[model samples]
Target: MTAAVLSSPGATPPSKCFTIDKEYPKPTLPSQTWVLVKVKAAGLNRAELRGRNGDEPAPPEFGMFVDEFHPDPPKILGEEFVGIVEEAGSETKFTKGDHCTGFIYGGGKAFDGAYAEYVICPSQRCFKLPQTTLSWETLGATTMSMWTAHGSLFQAAQLTKGSTALIHGATSSVGVWATLLAKAQGCTVIATTRQSSKVDKLKSLGADHVLLEENLGDHLKKLAPKGVDCILELVGPDTLQTLALPHLAKHGSVVVTGVLTKQWAMKDFTPALIPPTRKMTFYSLEPGQEEDEGVEKVIEQVIGKVEAGTFKPEQFLDRTFSLEDVGQAHEYMEDSKAVGKVVVTVP
Candidate 1:
């Protein structure tokens, strides 16, 4: 296996390398726990860029097909990938040539990722993609964002039909998914973006209302006259306190998934108690967490919605890059200007 790995913390990874170098050992073969995938499409995520930039640590087992986990140096930097099954270890449901979309559970963060032509992934994390429907780019970007949005809305927050949802950073990857997912469930979707020019684009993507991030509070007040039923909170500390907590309607819930803000400090928690009452739910997409337990069901439902034209995932792709352009991909994420998901094409 030839693959790319984070050479050192803060160091640009060597453009390419073979899998059997002494530092990068061969993965366990013919095992039931892993499957070999011929990588077709890969999506760039914030975490991978962070690892490359030295903000997040890469573990020692990264370059190796299988090694111990590290948050930093030595780890591979891919998370979600779509591909054809080259081989399935025993205990896996997939057969050769099966189209699939999957996350590299602990592997990309702990070991070699999907930036290469082939990658190995845990059997449990993989899913057979919809036949003849989704493109490789769509499948690659679907998991983390869709699962995060779906789990937060339906599983954690229990957003129901006719609910009103205010989604912050509405044009980003997760925000777009949250908007569509909310609409599919019969909710009135409100999306927020700092760029005034993006308002119409958000509306076209199914958002019933679009507000500038600065005006979220006032926008919700006028739209509902009673407060919103749900909040999809993606921005960090600064925006969280004002837009999410206070604007929620009675019995309303807010789900926080990303920390896009620079500040980490938390101001005094002024719990909102409105005429109807409100609740807050913290959402993180990490595997093995209790919040992720029902993610698959939500993904299935969202996938169905996407296929039926009730929601659209392909519309969210703004740009696509190759595996060799990994650095540029990360730069795109860090720049924070993209309106949707940034995909990486793995040849």
Candidate 2:
């Protein structure tokens, strides 16, 4: 099996973090509940970069997060991927040739991850993708972003069909999905991006109105005079408190999905508490963490919509790279200002 390994700590050139191992041992099922996946396509994630750039190994407990799981030399570094089930354990529901995509446990540590030609994963965590017209590159790149976007909109924000949605950081991978999903569900979408050049792009994706990050208040007054029903804050440098809080309608929903500013929590967390519907809460994306355990269902629902032609997810794909050229893919991720998703195809 071939895989990309994180060979060292941060380097002068970011691409130097990885070394290709053509003879890397292929992973096998550790238990009857696991399946061996032959990866077709995978995406480069920021979390993988953070893991490589970290000063030293993090604690074992850090394995729970997709972003914080680097412990010294990490395994094949891919959290999200789309693949075919080459082998399944006796107790598993999947069989040979089942097409699926999912989040890799421990990001890439609990098992060999999707950066390889093959990876062993727990069968339950895999979401079976429907047979569709979508390409492998699109499916691989769209899974995590669409999964998180669907959970945030339907599960966290409880967004409705006629609701008005304000998506901050509209060009973000997740933000782009949110925009398309919200519009497909018949909502009025107000999307914002820091770059003026992306304004036309967002509009083409069905955003009702596009706003520049500058003077968001003025833009809101003209587009959403009564405030929006939901706000998806993807650039949370406290934008939820500073920019979005003022624009939220009475009893509206606001969910912070991204941390581009590297600031995790709000400075003034208390003041966001006002109306009863705006109750303070912490939402979890961990598998089976929530009471409903409907995270997987939401994942299927979003993909099912894509299969049915609800919204064209391919519009969000930025580009593709071969498995051996993954270092170049990482470099592109580091240099490119585009928020669109980049995929790596395993040939």
Compare the candidates by lDDT and give the number of the best one: 2
The lDDT per prediction is 0.70, 0.75
How close is every model to the real structure, measured as TM-score? 0.80, 0.86
By summed lDDT, the worst window of 10 consecutive residues in model 1 runs over 13-22
C-alpha RMSD by candidate, in order: 5.0, 3.3
| Cα lDDT for residue 323, candidate 1 | 68
Tens-digit lDDT string for candidate 2 (242-289): 677777888888887776555566676675345555532333366555
* Angstrom error at residue 305, model 2: 4.9
**For candidate 2, what is the lDDT?**
0.75
Off by over 4 Å in 2: 55-73, 109-112, 271-276, 280-284, 289-310
Clashes by residue pair, model 2: none
Where is model 2 poorest over a 10-residue stretch in terms of lDDT?
A: 55-64
